[model samples]
Target chain A: MKLVGIAGTIEDHSYNRTLLKFMANHFSDQVDIEVLDIQDVPLFNQSDDQTDGAPVQYLKRKIEGADGVILATPEHNHTTTAAMKSVLEWLSFKIHPLAGKPVMIVGASYFDQGSSRAQLNLRQILESPGVDANVFPGNEFLLGNVRDAFDDQNNLKDDKTISFLSSTLKKFLTFVTTINDMNAKVAAADWESEDLGAHGHVDTTIDGLDMHAADWVDQATKKTNAVSGDTYVRLDCGVLTVDQLNYFLNSMPMELTYVDANNQFLYYNHQTDPENMSAKRAPAQVGNPIEDCHPKRAIPHVKQAVHILRSGQTDLFKLPVPSDGSKADMHYYQAMHDKDGNYAGINEFVLDILPIVKYYLGLTGQKLVKDPNATDALTGASKKSDDAKPDDVSGASANTDEAPAEKPAEEPKPDVDSVSGASANN
Target chain B: MQKFIAMVGTNSTNSTNRKLLTYIQRHFADKAEIELMEIKDLPLFNKPEDRKVPAVVTEMANKIDAADGVIISTPEYDHSAPAALMNALEWLSFHITPFIDKPVMIVGASYGALGTSRAQEHLRQILDAPELRARIMPSSEYFLAHSLQAFDDDGNLVDEQNIKKLDGLFADFQIFVKISDQLKNAHGANYEEVRNLDWNK
Candidate 1:
């Protein structure tokens, strides 16, 4: 199968285009690779019909002939490049060449953030419109510090980057072949028609956005709840779920965070009352590099946590609860896992049990005596108190077998970046 | 008077690398002319009816061909060079093998600690391709780290220490370009031999 790679630049010395050139040359023997030039293609507008035109004709021919297409592009403001969108627009007008077509988007940027947001956004856009894209769960070719990677002669000089790219290309090649074979079968024997009944139409009631984020959060909450079931918390990809996330935030006294596999900020719990922190912060920080948040000294520990989490390991890191004259120490238990039981990333759940400590210290339950000031309501604990420390908590069970009222424990607010229930494809 | 050219290629609107290049361009303004080439203007590549090329393509090719030496300020993406930058380089090659035995210096910067190391390595491999005739700066010579904050508000390399590394890298690149010119004038016997070997093999 022939695989075609397209680069999204028109410079005389674009490093990304050169990488495509090298890949083309490397794979020239096994596959016929062609470099696409978008120079002649007019700005994509549906009104301008170019069915028989030169640029559109070329694009259609390429898509029709090739088994798969490789798109290498630059991230522009956390979204797909205008040039790339133009190509899609052109395609969408005629044949929708991207629909169900297996494509791989790989590119570079100087930002250590690794263009994950841009790539994720592009992948979503591509898949949003009936287009199927093969997005790797993690970054496929995230090359940081591009400035030093090439020589003056406009060639890539990095070895490990090349090695990994070649390996990744190998996987892409396999996927393309498999996809091509499937397409061929569907076309030749009407296989898809026969199996149409088995795979019915997908329900589109919920926008793909909410469907995925919701699914992710639901799974995450279920997993966390399953562990001891005493703690109630919520995790989000970013700070978007403020109202729902705040339920968790106000309920818990500890800070919580949800990050993607690459450690991009998904969501962060806001410090309650905001008396000490900035009120309005950059939402873009939701997808910023995790390392940017910590001091240089803490990088090693963060890296270790990431490694352990990525390798399907759950780690419990404990910090002595701060003994600020009035508070008891706290414990931090971080559970990291993918929704499908794979290693997606990490979640930091901060539990401050200082109030519990206070309760445990004063180990006596007091009953109110009959007095004019002792109202009936004053004899029992308030609903909020019951919810805060339910009957399940140690030494907190009320006497008699009567089921206690279900109190609302504050759920850990979604991290500042979480868009839980959003599709992982993004 | 010796001629020199500085080219900035990046996709970011507020590119720190571009700002760095702007600083370097000002430095060269005293001795040479510098131009900033924006990749955003170029259209996507299409192979159908590959006929007359676009004007920007021709303009870019001409710039690279006429330049005495090329200094590239690249931005890293996804652990590699941005495909936009890579596409620009490919388009340049298609017009005229401006990369063959040409004096080229690659430098990059980013907000990250290691700079564009991944992109640097990726570019190194591309330049080292069997068909491409080019010289590469050693890893130690390539300066790129914490460069976003390295520049002053005036768009000058404010960090004296980093400026020193850039100075060293550019100085070596200058020498490489001069030597390359001499070889080009001398019929580039070594480059021809390499090309011939590649063709015959």
Candidate 2:
């Protein structure tokens, strides 16, 4: 049996990572272990399938192929690590990759009990899902005083624990081998249908659930009770009309969150208008704490933008949120100024322009904004006006003061790569 | 009378899974004594020759030896079983075929989507060892989805759907364990009887 050791931790000096290294060396002659990194994994989001920006596809494949997995986890916020849980969230796309897999969990921590509570908490989260972990006869490896557990070479110091671990592997191997032998032909019965829910169509697969998108969307305040000046005013609820919704939805390049300054979430145009719900994949995020939805790594950048917008500056920040291996980048523009030129709190807009780019590339159909008079008939601002115009388009006369005040018949084409790169820099 | 050991793998200080398993043990509490194995203490797995057999390993082996049957309640991680729990399994595998001919039931729970189906599948694959007697529970029975929210503070299944699933799984597991124990004690003589199982139920 190939003994795959799962190492989770993006950092270089992670203690759990070190423990994985020790396991690698200890089982060098007997097993093959690989460290699976969660760094490249985008947050899982189901709606990403409908958007031009899609989530990663290969991460789930790795978990499916592993024999016995060993997880080296660190404790965070008094429980299992966030990155670790994030990986699990991604895995939830599948029916049950972890269900019957033989697993060995070992953790390292600076504190006493060796991050035991975190490990235990993680186990609870794992077991809650149906893994028959060979937990009995009490299988726990808590390396309290983690410093002592590792030697000068950064390997496990104790020899006895190693033997026990080896023994555990033997037992697990036997169990795995036995099970596989019994169910040897089980793979043949998998699917006869061509559309066997391929690509996470089945809720049990990785493609079905959008964990990254969920996390990103979840960061915002989902519950919004409008409080205007003192009285709780109720804005329109339920779906709007098809024509109005379609114009509002397709007119803007970005996913717009119309906030009336006090950081209160007001409205977001549903992607698929109610009338055309079949072809439409509405944005999963409706009313949520906008801040909570950002990537942890990108939180600081978002804060900086929020700060600038709050301080009366129309901060235009562009970032390439990781979309699978390639960048399905988006541009964020927040302006505190109101429609009346009065200072409102902020009008935040997030636009996934990958579709626009793909359209521009001739790889897809109509341009992102297909309106005949691309600009607003009233405001004279083009529908894609807020979208960052690459230098190729930016240098055009439309960006100049001398350009025609009347609506232009054609939108200036942009240098897709350059503009996307520019958007990602912030 | 032969004794059966129920090993519950959980990390929560007050785990709902543990509480559920505890309630099940109570049913057998008067009929038979049960050993509740605590895994929070085992040392990290390293080669014994390199690190020596830690006391925790020996204690774990002792519990396995004393029990006629072992029931493990595993936690799901990364759509699989927790590494900590797996590590324990690794330790047990290294010690002996503690799972050999030992009757086992795999049950799982989750707070979201399809329950712990992934973890349970992984566990089933592990338990498929020829030496291990896996009393496989049907997918519908073993899975308790949105389980975290189902249990109240007192560990009772507040939702009817979850309660029904849990009850069915527990009942099946009890039968599986009892039958498995009887077959194990009878050795190969009762192996034929144990093999004739209605796994679908």
Candidate 3:
């Protein structure tokens, strides 16, 4: 394994530097350790970076080239020296050189407490999100009273300290090698494509349900109340009550939320079993701005999606919310349109379909028999049994009433199965 | 010294990623025999036609087959690898199978904050195709973000630390390649057996 030891202090007679040199010599057989001097590294400045200074760039490259880094620090004011901080600051420019880089920090000081405070401070800086340097989780090396610990030639005289440092270096070498081996093994594994055979057909079962049906029913019922003083709308087959409309939206075994064109939180279905829901929706959120309803981290993504939807560039956005284990919760957002083809709002649905997905992929012991009545169950055609036609569940004419007559809805095939197949192949 | 084939995924005339590859070649000049492989002359890969093998592709395959290791530097386009690079890889994957058990290292330079991390990931997936089977150097991903500021007018890496990093990667890569070569020889042409050998030892 190759390791680079960086002496944190720039002083000519620094104990930390001497200690690093001793380590390099001691571990010569197992590792090729090089002691890098940071004296030439310039104070980081954004303007200087524009010109691309040679010294700062060199420092960044050196750290990048190493398998692991050994930062031998010296204490000043109970913290890391200015030199160490300056090097870290330079490496953290637009590109983070230290991100995920395994690092080990050791400090040597004249005081009895050694440079423990400096090492602690350095660990915090290395772990900061911006730097993200992976410091060894435990086993700190603090050489206190360093003046008498080493011989005149800067060699370690203490047998106890030498043994401690040797064991730490050996463990550090193993850590570096293990990571390297794992990376090689992953790279060696063939993951580009797989023959999923007929497994790709499973995702096709859930395609093309009327995304706007629930909202359209709600709007049509509201208009009936305003015009005729009736709280229900008479449909083609039967009388549709306001309570039935609410039931239709909430009975889909998924969480539903709607945001208007003005980015307002209009409504969200209250889950009967709150504990089973992935995201909770409170009644107080109604009429609030969509931005306020989402956590701050998710606000930017929501705004971008809303902007894209309002522009009519694309009407659908699908994402998988990460879960604890192998299964992931799926979220789908579809843009709703008014009678004149004006953008109205968005309908968001979050569903946990891991069990269904697992069954289709043959991961579960269960078999997937094509549910002949799935289309009927999805379109509410099952509710109006008298008007239900076998062809009405075909998906070609389900949205004919709302969609323009010029463009008929295409047959909803199992598109997701093919997509999942492609992902499986990758 | 081992011979390595350095490939840049982009065919752009002034690609910074290509410049990065040239810098890497210079850095490893003392330790390895680095050769620059150009994909500009190769035609776009046609699945049916490439199965028969074109002369240019044949020559490129031969070069890869002869090299001890392969180093690729790529730029991300639309969150994936450039079409030109993918085309070449497809040809190599279908025809020669030069990457089978081969030692490969990936590096990238980009102007964006995420660098070419996404593209590198995409490339890793592609290289893992059953036919390619390239053994890539695992954990260390060299993403030189803000690459516009990473080099000087002379095309040398401005950051000395970055040069040292390249040096370290080359050192590890050399060892990895040597071990792979030893394993291949020991197994006596049984690719599967060689692949299954515990490489860490």
lDDT of each: 0.55, 0.52, 0.67
Model 1 reaches what TM-score against the true structure?
Answer: 0.37
Of 1 and 3, the candidate ranking higher by lDDT: 3
Query: What is the lDDT, from 0 to 100, of the residue B156 in candidate 1?
Result: 83
Predicted candidate 2 versus true structure: per-residue lDDT over A333-353, tens digit per residue: 455564444445445455556
lDDT at residue B127 of model 2 (Cα atoms): 56
Tell me candidate 1's fraction of native contacts, as a decimal between 0 and 1. 0.03
Q: What is the lDDT of residue A6 in candidate 1?
A: 72
- State the lDDT of candidate 1 residue by residue for A149-174, as single tens digits: 66666556887777887788778877
Please state the interface RMSD for every predicted structure, separated by commas: 11.2, 14.6, 22.6
Q: Which of the CAPRI classes, incorrect, acceptable, medium or high, describes model 1?
A: incorrect
Model 2: runs farther than 4 Å from truth? A1-426, B43-53, B129-140, B145-201
Candidate whose lDDT is highest: 3
- Each prediction's total of clashing residue pairs, residues at least 3 apart in sequence or on different chains, is 96, 90, 19
Which residue window of length 10 is worst by lDDT in model 2 chain A?
Answer: A392-401
Shift in Å, residue A121, candidate 1: 22
When summed lDDT is taken over every stretch of 10 residues in candidate 3 chain A, the lowest stretch is A392-401
Model 1, runs deviating above 4 Å: A1-426, B48-52, B130-132, B138-140, B185-201
